[model samples]
Target chain A: MSENIAERVKKIIVEHLGVEADKVQDNANFIDDLGADSLDTVELVMAFEEEFGCSIPDDAAEKIRTVKDVIDYIQKQV
Target chain B: MRRVVVTGIGVLSPLGYGHKANWEALVKGQSGLSKIRSFDPTDYVSQVAGHVPVGREIGQFNPDEILSPKEQRHVDPFILYGMAAGQQAVQDLNWLPETEEEKNRFGVYFGSGVGGLMGIINSGKSVETVGPRRLTPFAIPSILINLIGGHLSIKYGLQGPNIACATACATGSHAIGEAARLIRDDRADIMLAGSSEAAICPVGIAGFSQMRALSNHFNETPQKASRPWDKERDGFVMAEGAGAVVLEEYEHAKKRGAKIYGELVGYGLTADAYHFTAPGGTGAKRAILQALKEADITPDQVDYINAHGTSTPMGDLVEFKAVKEIFDGTNVAMSSTKSMTGHMLGAAGSAEAVYTLLAMQNNVLPPTINLDNPEEETAGFNLVPHKAQEKQVTYALSNSFGFGGTNATLLFKKVLNET
Candidate 1:
């Protein structure tokens, strides 16, 4: 289930940002490494919540800046 | 006053995509109206629309050519149509402002009659079904009427005046007319002006259908739906498209050896202040007279008129009465290209303006198709019925009147010789 969550999070990021799957590594920051604005990051968070069937609060969404952050958050929540 | 001339034009209509294709199909008396395929219209009262054909044909529109997948997801179709037409015009003119000074003198003025109704509806449904937090971040910009101009200004790096007119069906005419004013006033050396519309969605059709403003009689025979001035006419057919023109100061265009289509000599706008949806003959007549007066020409000197004939019963006769009152005993031939392109709402005015220029250049007037049984009141005016006509057009007028009784007229004079 943890591995599935990581794959799903990466898929959502790649699809939302139109970024390369290879570039979406665990340590890759959404805004720094991937080309995503503030709004795009928020949208990606919403997409993750919908995919994992969990609610991501606003404060928590702001802390989710990297691919690993999203994977870790989802693994703990869902 | 600095004189203004049309340097380039672009059009994306149900008739065709580019201006050339649209002109060719138009003069051939082709009807672009068909059964609405963008959405299932089984529940809609008016099931026909003039949607831009999607394909790889010379004049057909391909969405992939205009926007990337992610960019497309961020905008509504109106913005895409506007950008497509605007890019065509910019490319046709080959005038890219490179220096900061030049960029500051370039601007974009585009509009839509009803902007992004589909986007709004879809966004609302998403928020309703899911939650408000699930809404896309681009929803607000996607539904903005002025985003067309905003997007164009950003893409082209235009730093001058960027604005939009939202006068319902008259949006295109108002945009072009006001943009010409900007050039004439020396605020901008060159301006891209036009209007786009993509409001043939379910709610748009339903709203107009509720007002009995759309034709529902000929859904099975879609081509015969928008019969302007004909006795069998019902209501206007909804359409989606965009039309844009590049307006430059006469001396500036001449200095650059630009190919001038024609000179925009007169622009007039007036309010009816009488009815919301119906035309007050007085205001339309005043607008026509105002344009002719500003052009310093009599009604007899005008050769052609592209009328705001939307195929509605009351609107057609009212506009005709106004034309007759103004052009009485004159040989000014008039035709409604809406008979072919359908009612493109905000795009109608600029598209008709482009058609008027083509008519003057080629000396061939587009026809008002489906006018087999012309109404008795339309007897005096040369309605250019059923087929295109070849006649040397000197001065032509394109008229657009919107729902709020806003009327605008643009007068164009053919340039016989290069100065």
Candidate 2:
């Protein structure tokens, strides 16, 4: 189930940011490594919430800075 | 107060792309109307429209040549057409603003009559048939009306007042007039002022046809659909397109060695305060007189007028009566290019304004083609019917009266030859 969450998180990141799928590694930082600005990060979180059927708070979204972090948050919420 | 001068022009009409193509088509008195190709039009009564050509004809629009795959998804065709004209105007001026101050001094006042009516209609139908979850995120941004100014300003990094006017068919004229005021009021040194429209869609066709505002009898001969001032005229032919101009301060443009097209000498805006759909004779006449007054010129000084003759039974006569009442004794050669290119709604005023400048430059008045038999009211004015005429035009005017009795008149002075 965690593996499925990781894959889904990577998919959302790729689709939302137009990034290559393989580059969305688990530990890659959204801003430093994935080339996301503040606006992009907010949109990515919204896409995650819509796709995963989860509601992320502002502080919770701020804590999610990588693909692995997004997966962990979604799993905890579900 | 800064005097506004037109240094560049961009056009995307049913006739073709850019100022040269549209001017050439206008001078040749060619019509761009045909059986509706954007949609089936099988269900609509008025099946004829002046759609912008997209195929490999001599002067057709090729979307692939303009926008990228990703950029195309973020905006509607209204934005695309407006951007194309804005890009052309920028390129024509060869303007490269490298400083933040230069960017801040440049602005865009572009507008449209409707807010992506076709895009909204298409998506609304899709949502009903396919559900809300199927809608794309870009749908909302793409449907917003003011995105033309937003998109064009972002593309060129113009940081001044980005305004959007939505005064029905008078949107373009109001945009130009307002932008010129912005320059005159020392708010901006330059402005990209105009409008765009691509409403040749299912709803646009049905809505206009239901109101009996579009030409229908000439479906078999679509080229003759928009016969303005002619007795055979039934209604306006709906056309889809855009037009733009780079308006700059006169001394600033002169300093930059910009080739001035014309001078925006005056602008007049008024309201009917009488009717919603029907035009008010008093308001329209007052608009014309006000424009001439602001220009500090008498009615006789004007040589040509590109009329907002939509070819409708009431509108055509109403505009003629107004112009006649104002410039009755003046030898002003008036014509409506709408006879050939159809009425382009929000883009109509700017498009005709561009054509008016072209006429002043070419020194040849464009013919109001398909004017087989001019009505008695149209007989007094030199309606330049069925054939082009060479008139040493130095000053010209363009009128745009729209729904809700919104009236606007823009007067331009020839400025290229003086230097």
Candidate 3:
């Protein structure tokens, strides 16, 4: 389940930001490394919530900045 | 005052993709209108439209060449079409500002009759079904009328005056005329000016159909639906496209050895001040004569006219009567490319202006198709019906009238070597 979550997070980031799949590493920051603006970050959170069947509030959403952060959050919820 | 001349033109019209393709199709009297294919129109009153074909063919428009699939997902079709046409015009002009001063001296003036109507309508549906939280972050920028100019300015590093006029059908003409005024005032040396529109959506069709402003009589024979000045004409057919031109200061263009299509010597803008939807008074007449006055020429000096003939009963006849009143004795030939390209709304004026320049360049007037029985008022008028005519078109004029009684006229004089 953990490996599946990691693959899913990378896929979403690659599709949303139109970046290379290899660049969406667990430690790579969405803003600093992946080139996402504030709006794109917000949209990425929404996509994650829909995919995982869970809601990430605004306060929690602000903390999600990397592929690892999304995997950890979704793992805890599911 | 600096004079302005048209150096490059680009078009993405129902007739074709490039200006040359559109001009060839127009001269051959081909109809771009057909049963709506973008969406199912069986439920709507007016089911015909002139939509841009999508492919990699000779005249088809392929948006992938301009934007990636992900990038295009954020922007509306109107902006995409405008960007494509603007890029084509800039490339045609072969000028990209590399220096700070050159960038500062470049500008953009683009407009649209209705910007991103489909975007707004889809967002409204999302709000009702999935709520606003699911809406995309690029919603606001995608729907703004001025974003076309904004995107073009950013792409070319143009840092001069940037504006987008939203004067309905006259938006294109007003954008070009106002950009010329900027050059004439020495504000900018070069400007990309024109308009784009893609509002042939469900709500757009319903709105115009409710107002009885579309042709429903020939949905079965879609090509014949947009017959401007014809006795069987009912209303105009909506179209989606863009037309862009590179307008440069005459001296600047000449110094760069740029090809000048024609010189835009005069333009006139006026309002009827009478009704919201219907045209009134001598506004059309006054606008044309005012343009002639500014051109410093008499009525007989004019050769060809691209009329604001939108196939509607009242609009076509009123424009015809005005032309008759002004060019009664002159052997001026008039034609409505709308009879082929349909009514592109905001893009109509700019596309017709490009067509007028082509007419002067090729000395051939595009014809108004499907004029089987002309209106009685058009007895003595040379409406250039059914077939293209070859004539020495030295001076040409294009007219555009819009809702809220706005009118704009642009006069183009062929560039003779002596001048």
User: Residue B320 of candidate 2: its Cα lDDT?
Assistant: 87
Q: Write down the TM-score of every candidate.
A: 0.97, 0.88, 0.97
Per-model DockQ: 0.83, 0.15, 0.69
Task: Give the TM-score, chain B only, in order for the candidates.
Answer: 0.99, 0.97, 0.99
The TM-score of predicted model 1 comes to: 0.97
Encode model 1's per-residue lDDT on B218-311: one tens digit a residue: 9999999999999999999999899999999988889999998899999989999999987774888888888998999999999999999999
Q: What is the DockQ ranking, best to worst? A: 1, 3, 2
Chain A vs. true chain A, TM-score per candidate? 0.97, 0.94, 0.97
Model 1 CA deviation exceeding 4 Å by range:
none
Task: Please report, in order, the local distance difference test score of every candidate based on alpha carbons.
Answer: 0.92, 0.86, 0.92
- Model 3: lDDT of residue B225: 98
Candidate 3 docking classification: medium
**Model 1 C-alpha lDDT per residue in residues A2-34, reported as the tens digit of each score:** 988889888998899998999999999989999
Chain A TM-score of model 1 comes to 0.97
After superposition, the stretches of candidate 2 with alpha carbons farther than 4 Å from their true spots are A1-78, B55-58, B416-419
